[model samples]
Target: MVVVRGALVLSLVALLLGLSAGPATAQGPKPTIVLVHGAFADSSGWRDVAANLRSEGYPVQTFDNPLRSPAYDSGQLEKQLATISGPIVLVGHSYGGFVITNTHDPDVRANVYIAAFAPASGEFVQGLLNPITYPGSRLLPPALQLKLVENDPTGIGGRNIDGYIARPYFRDIFAQDVSPAVAADMFAHQKSAALVANLEPSGAPSWATVPSWYLISTQDRVIPPALQRFMSSRAAPGRTAAVDASHASLVSRPADVTAIVLAAATAVQR
Candidate 1:
């Protein structure tokens, strides 16, 4: 009788302890961060941003955007996402925004756009700037200022071609706020984006369903600040921050970009 009573008491104690400890148990694994660079820039642009994220204890990955068609680039990114086991915070800059828009990966917990093109369904990067009749359209005559270095015939329908910013215009348009020396070096190494990548229409934007954040670069000459504001408002992102940096804010203002990315990462933790 005494043994039975003791067993019952012990069982009750164990149940109470389990219930009390439930909320204190470990949460699931942390989400990994995937940084996608925009056109003309390589993964090297994300070096500072990635470093900051890693310092914050985040598992970071930087994907080199092929600057190909939206569908093709997104498809490639989707493959990379498949390799990650935990949740992801997918971040895109400039043309990279269009790539992430097409990705409907289930593991993406949040989307972050850094002075990028957040096109809606049926809208392409060119279409966004094509309608701009005013002089404020920074990208209207991008080809004229960008020097053509290569004529790679590997793009979609052989229509897409690559071009880099001319040394003279590189500092003014792409990285206005960056030092002259750094801008020159960046211009020298800048990869030419396939022209078709900007012309192709975006599929259903993942931002439509997933939560989003935007880091608008007010001084951005590639994608104008007004356009960034318009797109960000249209998406109704969870958070929006504006910085005084240029289009290369990822490199010029890494801390600001890192903060917004970290916010998205922190939110997904809850």
Candidate 2:
């Protein structure tokens, strides 16, 4: 199933480049693509991108972020980062960008931000929520809030979220790159509540030190493309690439996202 999708997406990418899907077998490095999903979603959301990346010969590992507290997820990520023997490229989406940036190990060869939040020192991920009014934050049902509170003390994290409220209110953080079907799937698979409390800012911002790349989803509904650009600028990545997709650009336009990740990885290799 994914092979067909990969072939199609890759072909489209080739066409965009004014080239055919030539016989050229692009050999990518062996380093793994460690994917960290954002709030309201789990690792499965990365399945589509992972499959396409594998087709390009890149090893990928999508983590099931506890979605509990940022600190806890960081611990989990640290444990995973310990197991990989080769160099690694850390990728994050939305709030997951905070997770990747905050929990980064000195060993990470590169970092990739896909319309994700990359906060700096002493900045909490939830601090960005300041723009959201208290009543607005309460847009989530109380029942849902309780569920998220259970998984993450900060009232964040869970995949069981679904309903009309999500569609009209929550769907746009991602750009128009993703199809309705894919957006629906992501909403269904989103983690309930990711703890924003006790979520400290990045200890060692990867953008400041690591070879980093940023993929901006111009049409993102959630994080606002403007905010993404501001954050990327602060991080000072090696390069920045723009895509006309949603927040879930990795899923909606995996080829472009993959290219950005590959570029980051290639720089690390150099």
Candidate 3:
């Protein structure tokens, strides 16, 4: 009887210890952060942001997002997310937002939108920039340069027109806050997004079911600040922040972007 009682007491003591421990005891390791870049840009644009996340001990991975259709890009991302066994924080910039939003990854702890598109079901990227719908956007036909993709190497259907920011207006529309030297470099490395990518109807947004956070760029010209406010509010995100930045907030304001992403990480960490 004494032996049994002692065993029960020990079990009780262990239970008490666990109950007294902080949230960290129940929390898993730091989540892997996956950043997806949108149209007209590539993964290299996330170097500074990824570096900041890495410094905080996060396992950071940046996607070389195919400027293909949203569903296709989401499928591409799924292949990478499959390798991660733990929690994940998905961060998207610009067109990258549509890609992340289309994901249904169960391990995604949070979706963070950095001056990105958080579109609704059946919404097209091009429609969002219509001044009649959400004014102040400089993404009209005049600001874009459409070129034919001869072979459609990314499998976005052959001979599709790819939309690129016009050379003269690239800096002003995309990264107004970035230095001229850096902006010029960014422009030179631009990736033209397939026209179908903008025209394709986005799948159901993960934001509808998953927790989300948004960092609105007040000085954004690519996506109007007002539209950012509307979309973030529509998502009913758990957290939202604003920065005095252009459309390339993730590049120009890496620290701010990192902070918001960190907030999402910390929330799920507990």
Candidate 4:
């Protein structure tokens, strides 16, 4: 009787160990992070952020938006989201914000907006940028200004180059937290699309239903700081932080952006 009891106890222990070391336990679910890049930018813009997220054990992927019409872009993004089998965290930058807002999937765990747009229902990018037209815009170096204008008519007209330079206009607008080298790299690689100009308004806002967190760049030059605040106020009233950087807070302040995303991911598990 004593031997039989001892044998039973040992068997129970072995069973428990096997369960704990099961194949299911060995292969854990991979956390998915889908990054959406904004206008005048591409997936390359999130290169640093994506690398940082990966170093920390995340399975990160970025959607290369054509920057076409908003609906067209959103449709493409949704197709990408469909491929993700598990819960996902969607991160959007600049005009990419509108894309996330429009393509938000119910399966997504959360939405993270980094110095990016968070348009409301029935609102478009123009609606957000038009309301905050400020006084004399920042000044840019004459040569650089001419480059921006000459190569891109979308830039401040032929005459506004100086005003476009002095104030850290475009660079500050997108990537304030990043280094000069990174920011310059971002600018050089920047690609503007005519479709971006035709992006339509958003129909249903993802933030209204999904958990959202916003990282507002206080020193932003492109999408005025006030405008970012307003967007956050309406879209993510409770989950917002003011970061002391320019527009590209994700690149400049990668840790903060990652923290916000990590917290959101944690909540999804609950």
The numbered model that scores best in lDDT is: 3
lDDT of 1: 0.77
Give the 10-residue window scoring lowest on summed lDDT in candidate 1: 1-10
Where is model 3 more than 4 Å wrong at Cα? Answer: 1-26, 153-157, 236-238
TM-score of each: 0.84, 0.76, 0.88, 0.73
Worst 10 residues of 3 by lDDT: 1-10
lDDT of 2 by residue, 56-80 (tens): 6778898887655566777889999
lDDT of each: 0.77, 0.66, 0.82, 0.66
Candidate with better TM-score, 2 vs 3: 3
Q: Over the stretch 236-262, how does candidate 3's per-residue lDDT look in tens digits?
A: 443677889999987888877777776
Ranking of all candidate structures by their lDDT, best first:
3, 1, 2, 4
Winner on TM-score between 2 and 4 is 2
Question: Could you tell me how far off, in angstroms, the CA of residue 264 lies in candidate 4 after the best superposition?
Answer: 1.2
TM-score sort, best first: 3, 1, 2, 4
Backbone clashes, each candidate = 0, 22, 1, 21
Better of 1 and 4 by TM-score: 1
